[model samples]
Target chain A: MVDDAVQRFCQQDLQLREALGAVIFGQPDAVDGATCALLAGGHLLLVGVPGTGKTKLAESLADSTGLSRGRIQFTPDLLPADILGGETLLPGSSGDRVEFRPGPVFTQLLIADEINRGTPRTQSALLEAMQEYSVTISSHRHRLDPLFSVIATRNPIEMEGTYPLPEAQRDRFLLEVQLHSPAPEVLTRIAAATTIETQMTATKVLEPKQIESMRQTVRRVIAADSVIDRAAHWVAATRPEDPTAPEPVRRGLRLGAGARALQALILSGKVEALRNGRTHLDDEDWKKWRHEVIRHRLVYSLEGELDGLGPEEIVSAVDRAVAHQG
Target chain B: MPASDSQISSRSRRRTPTGLRVPRLEPRLRAGRARILRHCSRRGAASGIAIGLPLATIIWLTDHDPGRAAFTAIGVGLLLATVFASRQRRRAATLWPRIWDRIIGSQSLIETILDRQQQPAGNPWLDALRARSAHLPLPSPTALRRHLPAPDPRPSLALTATAMLIGAVLGPFDPIPEVQLNQDSGSTSVAQISSELPTDEQLRSRQQRIRGREDAALALAGRPALEPLARQIRGLSPATTAPQSLLPRDLQAVQAALQRLAAGDPIIPEVALWNPLLALDSRSPMVTSAALPGDGASLALSTDPGNEAVTRSTALADGGSDRPTDLSPTPFDPQLSAAPIDSIQLAGTATDDASDLRLDTSVVTPPGEESAASWDRVRDDPQLAPRWSRVIDLYQLWIRGKEGSGGG
Candidate 1:
């Protein structure tokens, strides 16, 4: 019965992805990645230049899911309370009462645009809400919706005044989807679509209840032991201290992802398998989702930075090492 | 989300052979694995033949020592074939997963089935999976073979056969007649030396010397007590005394007579003509008569006492003037015969053919030259004497009794 529901949800989610793709022209991979993170109940970090449709993709994602959406334009001066909500004094009938004003994080989908523009303290405020789906403000626990997903964006070009997200905060996001400029043909199609006077609104492809149900079904999607083993082995090989790590990884890595990385791999792998209409997961999905899962979590060493090596190289090394196992 | 007991039991009731109803896919998987191994084995065999045949053929064509070439070819063929087969087998073993994927017609279904097989505890998800997969058709051996790529046989067979044919036909060839001609041409008219029986004059001179030694022996004996042995020695016909044809008994008699004379006086050694050609070369011992220009030269012979007097006087001076000289007239004194045989041998060439060369070790010399220039020609000849003498040593008997013997 659960497999049947997951299959139905997979079809619905693919339709939602198609709807988002129509709004975000020429970014099919980004749209699919965003849809996967949203349906899997995990946050996404979009990295790209200023006008590559990162915010537009997030907005389209909200519209297609029909989830209540909130936006916070993070700046250098932004405070933790500005994102997580703060207590305000309100006058009651007989005495003054302290009430909490819910922040933008209290929604189904929250978009933190230019998240690197905010200080590390303010950026870390969303870690709890992104990971636990709840915010703790002044001893008061406010639970966000179970279907909440934070879609954060950062402009890679303009970095003069912005504060980059710390590794701890970056690790909360399940995927860091990179957005690129569209090809000439796609750019032309985008120009044609924008010049027309007709207003385009994304149709609601999934409801909040359906998303919650899909998350449950995603959990039930069978991850075969070998697929889990493959993901675990790859994640283990990412650590420089791990015996299975290849030499390149040992040379360049300072900090490796923790068990959360493995969870993200298996979860994303399950989502990919279900999307492919397979009841059981396989290493193919794990390979497809590895870079997105590991890219944000890896902390490179000083030499690695000097050598201009990035997480993508180490992730590729880990992948090649695991591929040769047996 | 988990399957309930009712769902599992109900699915079990409707099991089909295509899916969950098949008790084990291990058998099919094992069979598929074996088929791939067999394919790899066949490929490895083809590779060995392709590589080994050409290599062996090249070796066979280039090797000059045909005695060892066949064995060398077989050894190299087996070594190359074994190395190639081992490498190919390793390559083929790594393709097992790909083979599994190809045979099952699905990407991860086999991994799923194998993963399920690893779990000892019952799994509701696995059961559900099996039930869902039950509707899909199982892969048969025929289907697997149909899915496999076709075998290739072009370059291996053609290249190996061509190499073998070329090695067999166009390899090195030399005929026996050409080899023989090369050997004969290499030996063309190089100077050759030959030895024969002594000439009549040389034999006569040798008999005269032996007679003189017998008379000296009788003198040393102090009486005619040695007369019988001297008579036996004189009975040797000087006209027909062929030293080459002397019997062992006649030599023993002469040796006994010399030993009796030596018993009377220890100064006497065995008397033999150590060199005939050099003895015949002196002016008085040989009378040279120049014949007509076309005919060979005529020569007369005699033993010269004048040369003997000169040789004896030289020996007496070397013995020191303080001691009185004994006029024993022994041709070979034990003291005079103390040097090695080759030091006293007159330089002469011996024949290479044993049939033409008769060596009388008792009196060693080469005789019977057609002319004086012929004797000179035999002495100056370089390639003939040292080489032939190494095989047939004629002067060894000059020192036969005395360990350090030489001429007077």
Candidate 2:
């Protein structure tokens, strides 16, 4: 099976993330979240307040992976054509025209910095491309590269002017990695590293297609029945309709993580396990990403901002409530 | 040394999906890039790039001269031809959209069914129909909405070639002429040649021909099977019009949005309203204006906050099954006097696994206002349109689900 070498190759894969950590520190979970997403053959959604090096972390990931990079900086004035693109007819010399042009969304790794900064209209253009891995324009269709992913970084605290990423956009991402401010030591290390023109070379280890196949292999990694059962139970217990859901979830919440939220855990769990060369998923893999998988999916009492009791807290509470079921 | 994060990331080689397949990306990418670059520079390559000619100025320079104009035009034509042919050869350009389009088609089916419910006439019969509609819930304390079986009929088909083309062009490129106009144009002989074009009259004629073809295409596409049905309804007496056709194009837009989201196509907001599903079902004539607000609120219960589980099904331990059924497969409820309908739809063209559930394609809604907002958001996505087009998926799953008196 290709997974064998990939399992062995995961050691190499692990090393790359490690190298990235040397330059960017204190956010092991964020790194793990991104790693898990990459291995699962899905994209990552990074959320945090501004000035947290979210952009830096994504850049480091791209550099470490040696994937060709493209970026779209979301702005309120940004149009759908600015990100997803449309056919732009450039005037040709003999009074003819140049063909249609594509936009920044077409790349091996697309870093959509401050994605929520864009308007909802501009924002939805990207949501579909992320899910379908394709775009339709001017009577034709375009497919994204196998390794194509939009590592969208969002600023949750600065919601005053930004539009929320649609729920469908949230659903499409394999992981929603939140970047906490780097600890003083990590910041110090980053500061020291940036003292110079901070250019480091990552060996060209794998091509986009190769990386894609490796991801498929990672998906094939085994997740034991019990682990799957635990994941399913955890998902069921979060829904307000589920009798087993927590008091907070049932009383205050409007919805719970349906089957897809459960799948995110199971799928990412397998990727997390295999990256460590472990054949079967363990409980820790799910625990590691518990927050990332279900955070945005939770719908708290309409008091989204006021009730401090968001999906993260509910998931943690549900995790506690359902521990015995595991 | 103990393994570290950087150690892992640094060593994480981009490997191929197949065994020992260190799939060569450099060549592939370079080839792709070369194709793009060649397409970008093809005209210049043949026409002999003029080092000093400002790209925009070159046209002015040639247009001013009577004798040199013809030569510039010929060069422009050849350059344009190369660029055009090379662009057409863009591998898999249509792949992603083609795949997504199939998903859109699949999702569009959901809107079709929902569209059936959206009558132009808001009347008592519509209320009776809502009460009668299999998926609509009856106003009750304990029970949830009664679901109908809207089964998916077909699998989607995706062309690989089109996908590659899409992926190749996802990155940004310097627009050849426009950039040259401002900065140093990579103008050599090729720039001059690529710029050559037909006269304005010829261009106008070509545009007219293309528009005509496009109109024909739109006419074919805009025509729905329901249009004839609509025509039949239009002929109905005014008395019956209110009862028979209650839905509007706006409602169809909402339905279309749902199908798009369901099929993993991106939902589009260009429609009349943002929250179509959550939009009030005023067509039910029995729905008195007295309880209008309550109707909107009651419909909100259809979705819930599903945070813990994303996409997994299993057989339960308490002699139960956790698998999500295709919505009341046989109508487990005794209350339903009608035989459970197995309304299998045309299946999606291409999917991850027709049998294996993809959380990306179909949504599992939450059962409250939160569910309503989230459902509306995702349903509006055109990318998810394909699954939504298979409108019956959620209903069918619910219909087939094991019905118990209360939550477990």
| lDDT per residue as tens, model 1, B1-408 | 767656644643445443544223444565655666666665566667667766777677777677677888888878866776666656765565455666665667666765565343355666776664545445555664575543355665677678778767876644333234443465432212112547687777666666665664454243233344344445443222113322233333334444444232322321222112322232111124342221342323223333332343344334424342332223434443432221122222222342333322222222333344544443344634343333223323332343343232
TM-score of 2: 0.42
Residue range B1-408, candidate 2, lDDT tens digits: 556655543443345344332212223333433433343343233322222122322442325354675567556555655555455434323221122212333211121222233333334323332332333222221111111111121211122233334434653333454434532545564556555757687777656544443332333234353333223223322211112222244233234433333221121221112221222222211124233332242221112223111111111112223332232113224443133322211111222232422222122332323233444444454644344424324533443351333321
Q: What DockQ would candidate 1 receive versus the native complex?
A: 0.23
Docking quality of model 1: it rates as acceptable
* Model 2 interface CAPRI class: incorrect
lDDT of 2 by residue, A1-326 (tens): 34455555587567767866665568777877886787676778888877676887788778777777889898999999888677766776788675667788888899989988888888889876887889888768898777888788998888688888877777777788888887888778767766778565444445565566667666655444555676788888888899788777877677667777777888787777666665445667766677788887766667634667776678777977797653
List of clashing residue pairs for candidate 1? B19-B134, B337-B405, B337-B406, B338-B404, B338-B406
Location of the lowest summed lDDT over 10 successive residues in candidate 1 chain A: A221-230
> What is each candidate's DockQ, to 2 decimals?
0.23, 0.01
